[model samples]
Target: MFGIDVRTARVVWTAALVLLGLYCIYTMRTTLLVMLFGVFFSYLVYPLFTLAQRACGLRVPRTLVLLVVFAAVASIIGLVGLLFGNQIVAEATNLGQQLPKLLQPGELERRLPLPAPLEPLRVRLGILLQHLLEGGTAQALPVVRGLGTSLFHAAGNLIYVVVVPIFSFLMILEAPWIESFLASLAQRPDGRLWSNVARGLNDVLSQYVRALALLVLATLVSYSVTLGLLGVPFTLLLAGLAAVLEIIPVFGPLIAALTIIAVAVFSGYGHVWWLVLFFAAYRIFQDYILNPWLMSEGVNVPAILVVFGLLAGDELAGVPGIFLSVPVIAALRMFAVQVRLHRAARLNAGGAAQG
Candidate 1:
């Protein structure tokens, strides 16, 4: 009775520690999320750091490489701001001024031309709009303002903006040490089964992240250049916003499209039809051509699983979680497959021994 089974005790201890750790994580999830974003940002920029390091004959430390990369990115952003910052600020101010008028009960009636046959429908819409403006708008305005404020607040969070970069830098600087430790773990008897699993996860996640970043960057550049050429108001802001939203799954693109179309319509942009056609064509091109070339081959996650994962992630942690969901699901699948293979091998070995 006093003697505990070795395996049972081990399992009990492990389970207790895991549960405790999970509880801690649940409580501190917001902090963990900021760190995770730092990790993601590091992953995206890592290849550039590696390239710069190699170009310096590997004498340049990763820390220096990271700093240089960050500086370069900052310079580019600053230059762009210098070029178009005033335009963006002016457009944003104009939009802000216009929003209240647009939300007025009669504003829609004035802007939108309804057919005589739809007069009743128009009247109903006016009533609905009046309700929204009179009662709901007060509530809605805070929510909208909160949404924007929360986004920038997260970015401006002292811990996020400062500590995250430090964490990212440490992670980058100590990556080799981390890999060595993981490799050492793999040498342990219990870890043999997971050695390949670790390596496979690294490969899969690295490739997926790099590809995804490239896709986002390509989309941003395409949107900015094309929209500018087409004389879209707030080209930089809209394109940048679209690129950020593109990181989210299904609903993101739709929201961006609707927002842009609404602006075009209300602003009396005569090229609204052209804008629609261009967006339609670009959507087709991206879905059929660009996505296949970049992502459709490598990840190969089932459509249903992808949808479910996105929904679950969105439910869990909003947009950032949505961004994390795919690679995480893919990694879990790889682990499951590895475990199944290992279990099969053990069973086969047992059968052979019996024979």
Candidate 2:
């Protein structure tokens, strides 16, 4: 009104809106994370939903199919918990009880005998290890506490657990409606590029999520069997930890190996040397063969790019960022491809018009 140019005002308004939206995101990041995870899990659930519907020849109602699929997944989780949950808990409790004793001064030296050549340095070695462990644990306390708080909050919030599933269920059922809404906003006059991008992202996400689940299961089984056969203490506990951490890619298995070997050495396992060799071999097999085969269809990002993404993601958002970096990079790559296709189509149409 006060001599503002119309175009300038419009630009100002758009910028303001973007800033407001960013503020909202910052304020509600926790809710957004939950929603994001719900969307991720919906991709996981939808394929099973589709598969079950196909198995039933589409005779069953979609809602019924979804319910049965969810029920089966829940039942399998519950059954696994029933089978191994108590022992894992027992092992965790035992670890808590034993950790203080393990940290006692000279305990490392007493428990770990030096080779004859290094026998004189046993006390120094123990002292160095004790100082390092205490220092590291002290430095790590805040992160560990934050993680524990997050887990406790997730477990304690009944609504969150229910809400996440409800989101997945609604997403599956109302997918068409959601698509239409997004289309209304996203579709452009000159091209259907947005739709194509969405589809590519969907395919990448679905395949990545399913493949990741399979990888985790394989790690759990392989580690459990190998550790149990090797008579390693806390086989189930360590295996479960490895499986959970396996989602983080490159650093996950390394941490698991170091932790497992440290536990073996501290617990006086005789075959610690054998465990080291086995882990080294297994890491090679998993990284070079198993990971590539599983992720080939979905994510084609190079190993160097993946490592860089992990570092960038870790800097930006810590562990969750590291876990999501590959998929995010894949989606971005897909977006770039769609843009190139759109540009080429425009060029071809322009040439045709000139002809």
Candidate 3:
């Protein structure tokens, strides 16, 4: 047996405990992801609930306001589902049916020009394509099987959904208590520093969420209008995809537009020029107008920093990382600023007294 001193044994035990904790978290990653999303959702919607409280006057309790807020969200979801359900379903089905044709070797090769020197690569690609087409059923069977597996995985998650709202509501309801607890943990007796940090976080988070919502809406509207005007089939589905992709910040909208444009090209749409125009116009609008205005209003995060944060988040945590990274970075920035200012002030006063 290896000889170990008490301190070494304790350190080893602590490291083992830390590793065990990490393993446990990795196992429960999905639930933790959902919970984090739920928390952010609550943060985003808190202002609306507060506004509802004000609109109701002091007569109605805050609990009632939360209920109203929940109902409003649920109603909106239901209304959208009711209004667009058939169109969405039809467009999704149409897109699925057209996907194979769209992916044909001739269609892809037509779209992408290959260099003459890359003939060998092209030949290999052609062989791969032929193999894919010939063994399409074999290749697709696993994917089809995966759909059933995914459905089974998702089907009985009602309890999780129910728990999310409950947790969100509690987080919102206990917001004041949470603040009090954090305040108590502050280094300074006055607690002003922590209070400032808390307020800054709230303000930044609120603005960022609002800006994201507006950007998503703008993207959805612009994409839907353009695709509809171009007579693109599956317009609803593509527009919805654009809206969802809008959540990813810089690269998302471009990907959505390119995907839609590709679909247009493959569908034998006569006015591909119009589709190109739409994408160009939307890109201009987003770059010149919406993004600058929305981001400026949301947080004072530099564009470069936002991109860096996005890359880092994606590297660290994939999609969830991207979603959570922005606000977390902004909050950290605010805290850092507060700390620097406080330290500078204290140092200046001490220097003046010494002089």
Which candidate number has the best lDDT? Answer: 2
Where's the lowest-lDDT run of ten residues in candidate 1? Answer: 291-300
The true-versus-predicted C-alpha distance at residue 261 of model 2, in Å, is: 0.9
User: Which of candidates 1 and 3 reaches a greater TM-score?
Assistant: 1
Ranking by TM-score: 2, 1, 3
Q: Each prediction's Cα lDDT score? A: 0.77, 0.85, 0.78
TM values, all candidates: 0.82, 0.89, 0.75
Candidate 2: regions farther than 4 A off: 1-7, 113-116, 176-191, 303-318
Clashing pairs in 1: none
**Candidate 1 local lDDT, 1-355, one digit each (tens):** 7888999999999999999999999899988887877777677768877888889876776677889987786688689889878877887889878877776657676655456888768767777766865786678788888789988887676666777767777788888997887899778867867787887787767777776787678778988998888887778778877777776656677778878877765565557777788779878987778777776443657778888999999788766678888888888888887788879988998899999
**lDDT string, candidate 3, 1-355, tens digits:** 5676989999999999999999999899888977876776787678888888789998988888898898898899789899998899988898888878767777655543356888658656655765765697688888788778866876777677777777888889888798787777565646767777777787787677777888888878887887787688788899999999988767887788777766776676667777778778878887788777876543756778879989999887766788877787888888888888778877898899999
* lDDT score for candidate 1 against the true structure: 0.77
Task: Rate residue 334 of model 1 by lDDT.
Answer: 81
Location of the lowest summed lDDT over 10 successive residues in candidate 2: 182-191
Model 3 regions lying over 4 Å from their true place = 1-31, 105-156, 179-187, 190-193, 296-308, 352-355
- Model 2, range 18-88, lDDT digits (tens) per residue? 99999999899778877878888898888788788899986788888889999998898899999999999
